[model samples]
Target: MSLGLAGVCLALVTAAGATSGSVVFVPVLSFTLAWTHSIEKVRWEEDYVVRPGKTPGAAPVLEAVAARVRGSGAGMEPPPDARLRHGWYEYTPTLRHPAELRLTRSGFTADYDWCTGGRCRSMAGLLPSNGGVTVLTACRSAPP
Candidate 1:
């Protein structure tokens, strides 16, 4: 009877583990406007000229944003079939010329690339304008 009881307990533990493991955690993408220097003098249709690579302290900014995102209960586990590794984006704005910079997880991953630049086609094509700093996160979708 003791042996049978032991076996039952083991089975119960195993079943519990399996059930917990099957629970899928979706990845959440987040973005923030590190800094924005307005060019109030720009004329023509261009309301404001956007230049990347200008933030003085970007490392800490990115780290803080990442921490906030993680703390928001967003699953940190990389997608099972995720081609690209999880990473962050660093947008650098300059006076003469600025460019949007991204440090993405290498490979053909499919999470979400948060950006203020035209890097992420999904976001670049459709971003609201207000001349202020902002944070953006990608929403998760089922594997294609």
Candidate 2:
């Protein structure tokens, strides 16, 4: 699936199969996901890149390039090869393609943050509040 300039469409759907929100990023590209650990209270971020699939009719490829965690301890341990720079422990994380992010709305912690094109916004603010599980996935954007 060669997207070319078609870009990618990200959909946020609730567990009950209702579409909450969606966004289209032109020219298939990269984005960052940030969130605070519930127990550790440390901020973590993952950088992901989206590209055309290897075959026709295939889903878009998703790859996480790097991850950064601020103040590691407890559930926030950085990898051994992680470098400490600017108060952040940075390292590349191993991930499988076609990643589907399942976000839980527990209302007990901060919502996940999505950043793209120099802007950042919480998932709660981006989508409708349903107090349920929300699945975030990438698909081919409709041609205009």
TM-score of each: 0.16, 0.77
Deviation (Å) of 139 in candidate 2 = 0.6
- Residue pairs clashing in model 2 are 1-55
Candidate that would win on lDDT: 2
Best by TM-score: 2
Worst 10 residues of 1 by lDDT: 3-12
lDDT of 2 by residue, 1-144 (tens): 343453445455666677666553435478888988888889999988876677876767677788999987775589888999999999988664646766676677787887888888886656644566666566666544
Off by over 4 Å in 2: 1-28, 96-98
Global Cα lDDT for candidate 2: 0.72
Error of 2 at 91 (Å): 0.8
Superposed by TM-score, candidate 2 places the C-alpha of residue 12 at a distance from the truth, in angstroms, of 5.4
- Residue-level error in angstroms, candidate 2, position 57: 4.2
Candidate 1 lDDT, 7-120, residue by residue in tens: 000001122223111212223222332221122211111111222123532211111222111111123332233232233222222222212222222123222233433333
